[model samples]
Target: MKNLFLLLLFVGYSQAASACDCLMTPVRQHIKSTPYLLKGKVIAVLDDKNKEGRDYHLFLRSIGIQDTVSRGYSVKIIVQQDFKGKYKAGKIIEIHSTYSNCDMLFSAGETYILFLHKAQGNLFPTYCSYSNILDGSPASIDLVQAIRTELKSRD
Candidate 1:
């Protein structure tokens, strides 16, 4: 009986951990599917009192493709109601996620390569999108290059 209980507990924990598992799609696909893609830093993170989520204002640093984006644009992201993370101002991060799979996780003062989607004139990040931290990894570098290539091709 004890062994069976332990096995069940382990299985439950495994399932919970894999709940947010997502398969990484190609960079081109991500760019083509979304309306906007850029690299920016978090200027402020505010609580949406009307809704059960948080809104993030990102300072647009560099855009992948030159569209109608400005230098300082606000990318409003709404996460789960229970989200309690602290996003300080002046933190460099990326925004590239959809709103289907899960909410994107971010930490202050960290740089990331984000893929962004537009809905109702608001940009959002999800866990199912292509994103990477600028941790000096070859994969991260490749992703950035791929985004630049895609943007150039569109032009």
Candidate 2:
């Protein structure tokens, strides 16, 4: 009986750990699917409590918790370069993101590549997408180059 209990406990823990698993999309595919893909620096981070307060609630089902624990954050970014979007350079835009495990937490003064989706007149990014901080690393450079190549091909 004890062995069976231990096995069940392990299984439950495994499920919880795998709750936020993300299958990152390839750059080419992400470019095609994402509505706004821009590289910019975050200028401000504020609570999303304006007209569209609490965009959505993420429910984690692993631990059987049925409460909406995460709130949305609005990140203001200054467009330095427009990779694939209507926003021109030097324009400031606000993107709504959640603090859930499967979402992004933006910080002020950090540069990031945003793979945004338009929903209800708001732009947001999912944790499973190719959006991430641009830290001048090889992975960041590779992604930017891939986006550039794909955009040129489309043109």
Candidate 3:
């Protein structure tokens, strides 16, 4: 029983670690950019959208970073999932996408990722991973959980 428990723990950790590594580096540093990149620790999770099915924000914290300078590189990451309506806030998940728009403060010319820790007010939940996205993490396909699929821009 002990051995089996340890094995499961190892596998789960290994998967998370790999996921984190996947989104730890900047885009310029890599030769080929993968779709999923960001990975981080979950801080909080909450839905900042109203019933109008218009507003949606997912907040997350950085689990891949060594130290958080200020707000832990908190970002309003965007999710692009066909079945986004199924996901709920506070579900510490991983994201697989590129930084479409950035404040240029933390990530400017880099292709990093953010892990889903918790949901912030409007930002939802996000963790800016300047490294690799967590391995065996939630499908990197969904960028951000949006109530609506059609949109002009995303963070």
Clash pairs detected, candidate 2: none
Candidate topping lDDT: 2
Model 3 ranges off by over 4 Å = 1-69, 82-115, 119-155
Give the Cα error of residue 120 in candidate 3, in Å: 8.3
Candidate 2 root-mean-square deviation in Å: 5.3
RMSD of each: 13.3, 5.3, 16.9
| Residue 42's lDDT in candidate 3 | 36
Candidate 3 lDDT over 1-155, as tens digits, reads 99999988876775465343224454233212222323334332222233211122112212222222222223333332212233343333432222212212223222223322233322322333323332344533343221112222221
> Model 2 over residues 1-155: C-alpha lDDT tens digits?
99999989987886676466877667788899887889999998776444333333322334454335555668889998888879888999988855555667667899998888887888888457888899899999998899899999999
Provide the lDDT at 46 for model 2: 79
Please state the error at residue 37 of candidate 1 in Å. Answer: 0.5
Question: How well does each candidate superpose onto the true structure, as a TM-score?
Answer: 0.53, 0.73, 0.19
Model 2: runs farther than 4 Å from truth?
Answer: 1-19, 48-71
Using TM-score as the measure, the top candidate is 2
Worst 10 residues of 2 by lDDT: 51-60
Off by over 4 Å in 1: 1-18, 47-101
